[model samples]
Target: MRRHVAEFPDARVVLNMRSGSWALKLPFLQEVVGHSLRSIYLVRDPRAWIYLMLYNSKPSLYSLKNIPQHLSLIFKDDAVREGCPSVAPEFKTIQSVLSRSEANPALVLAHLWLAHTAAVLRVNEGLPEESYLQVRFEDVVNFPQETAETIHTFLGVPLSPAALNQLLFTTSTNLYNLMYEGDISPTNINMWRQNMPRKDIRLIEDVCGGVMKRLGYTRLAS
Candidate 1:
């Protein structure tokens, strides 16, 4: 990442990471990112986040075997240091949660959501305030212009009218295929309600209640 950024002056790079869980476990990578790195920690309601990951791929739900293997792959990077055994006590917590994933997948997913996000929060603790921006996924989708402006300001770049319009237009146009039933809109904020079972919903809230509240998400009454 440093090498790529060094080649071009004024190049603002966005490294969109897919697996926050993997990234959270990799302290070496986080160290390499360094305190000077500017980063955005975008998160979603765990219920929705887990639903999208598990339900979106039919095969994923049926195959519990892939869960650990998929997670362990991030350790393969030579720069990532020795896996699992070397990680902090949090590694035991992750393993304990994952052990029951085969029997109660939703619970495990919710635990993972908290574990991964907590890691990011831990790493961001000492970073200069301007070096990091923690944004919510729903906000980006529901309030495009406002969110874009926040991001632009955080990056120390101008949010020109033309650029703002382009950002808003692209977000609305690039809807997730199959995952989204209609055009991009704030209405999707509650789409998880339709996809998640009540049991799973409760499990998610149980595991992620504190973090969800910390992120300003209101819990529905049981």
Candidate 2:
């Protein structure tokens, strides 16, 4: 931090946070990126995040909390739509691929996503709006240009129109879906719902019922 401050005295650093920070009490942030911090928090729906983590479980920060433990704030209706939105891919083709979870993945994923989201809201609480910024991960996936533009404005950086165009049509992230079978997971950009067993879906619904309905994730149309 001392060197960074000395090198770029007026440089305002923006931390691009996704998940794990809020869920794990942010000890990781304090250790790695806390000093000399101007923060922009990008949050995702814990439920949608569940889908991502289930397939892309990065040990770096993903923690699975199967059961809900009491926290400071009990979530109510109209949860704040932080800057980043979490995406739940309801695309029909993708669902048919990730249908197999060795264990009860639906409920597990739901719990993890919701619990973590709650944690982030708590961590971001009381943080001055300027010092901390919140965004939804989903908004980034579906509307990259708009999302990127928002990010650009937030950080006061120049985002070229060409760069935004490239992000919009990219198929790289589709690899996450089993849309291409030989692949481990479907890549139709999310079909977790279509492929998951009915029971598992029900389980997820039970655990994350409120969020699902509120966020319109209960059912998908082809």
Best by TM-score: 1
Q: Per-residue lDDT of 2-114 in model 1, one digit per residue for the tens?
A: 67645654555454466444445334444555544566778888877777656755565526446666555534442534443444344446566555645466766676678
Candidate 2 segments whose C-alpha is farther than 4 A from its true place: 1-8, 11-37, 45-103, 171-187, 210-222
Model 1 lDDT on a 0 to 1 scale: 0.67
lDDT of 2 by residue, 129-153 (tens): 5445556655666667777898877
* Candidate 2 lDDT score relative to the true structure: 0.48
- Report the alpha-carbon TM-score of model 2 versus the true structure: 0.52
Candidate 1 regions off by >4 Å?
Answer: 1-36, 61-65, 72-85, 171-183
- Top candidate on lDDT is 1
